[model samples]
Target: MLSPFDAHIDAELAQAVATIAHLRRALEETSTPGEAEEVLDLFEKLLRDLERVKPTVIGRTRQHGASWDAVGRSIGMNKDAARKKYNTNNVQRALARIQDGRPATPHPQRAPVHP
Candidate 1:
């Protein structure tokens, strides 16, 4: 059975795919430079949004007990590449927060240490 997180990811990816298809059709049907530019801008924004969500999705998947190999397969990468890209201290902390039943926001900055 798919987890709730998996279902959410599926829904998001489906929406993104549909939006991209619509943008592609719009781009193809554009009669004026301004319309094409608008479509391009929307596409850029969608790309940015996907980039922002990718790490969070990966972190959540890892938190749900997925292995790096599984993540890599899902994303069309190798295990080492997936680990190198998504395995960061921030991601780890976020996963920790999720496991701890807290919101997965960034931890506050620490004060400098003195010798």
Candidate 2:
């Protein structure tokens, strides 16, 4: 059984997915340039939000013993790609958080096992 926190997160994710689907359909059906641009703007905002959240989520996963290979598998990418894409941003953001006196995600206590 899912914990309450997990359930709430799952529900929110589902709702967000549903909303995205609705927006995609509306975008596809748009006939006028202005309407299409409006839909595209909303889509761009969603993409921006995802970009902002991605590094933090990656950092959280690392703190919780997730490996780059595992995370890559989950997202359909290779570990090298994952690192190349996010590691610098992750380090920079973490440093900024620390400098700001905020508790950033903790680093893994042990190195990940290699296969």
TM-score, structure 2 vs. true: 0.51
Give the distance in Å from residue 88's predicted Cα in candidate 1 to where it truly belongs: 4.0
- lDDT per residue as tens, model 1, 20-112: 988888888899766667687668656754664577698787888999999999999999999988886766664455457564443343333
Record all residue pairs in model 1 with backbone atoms less than 3 Å apart, i.e. clashing: none
The numbered model that scores best in lDDT is 1
The list of candidate 1 runs beyond 4 A from truth reads: 1-30, 90-115
TM-score of 1: 0.55
lDDT of model 1 at residue 45? 55
Show model 2 residue runs off by greater than 4 Å.
1-32, 88-115
lDDT of 2 by residue, 1-115 (tens): 9533244335446656765886788788899776666576667645544444456566656656899998788778999998777685765675466457554453333333333
The backbone clash count of each candidate, in order, is 0, 0
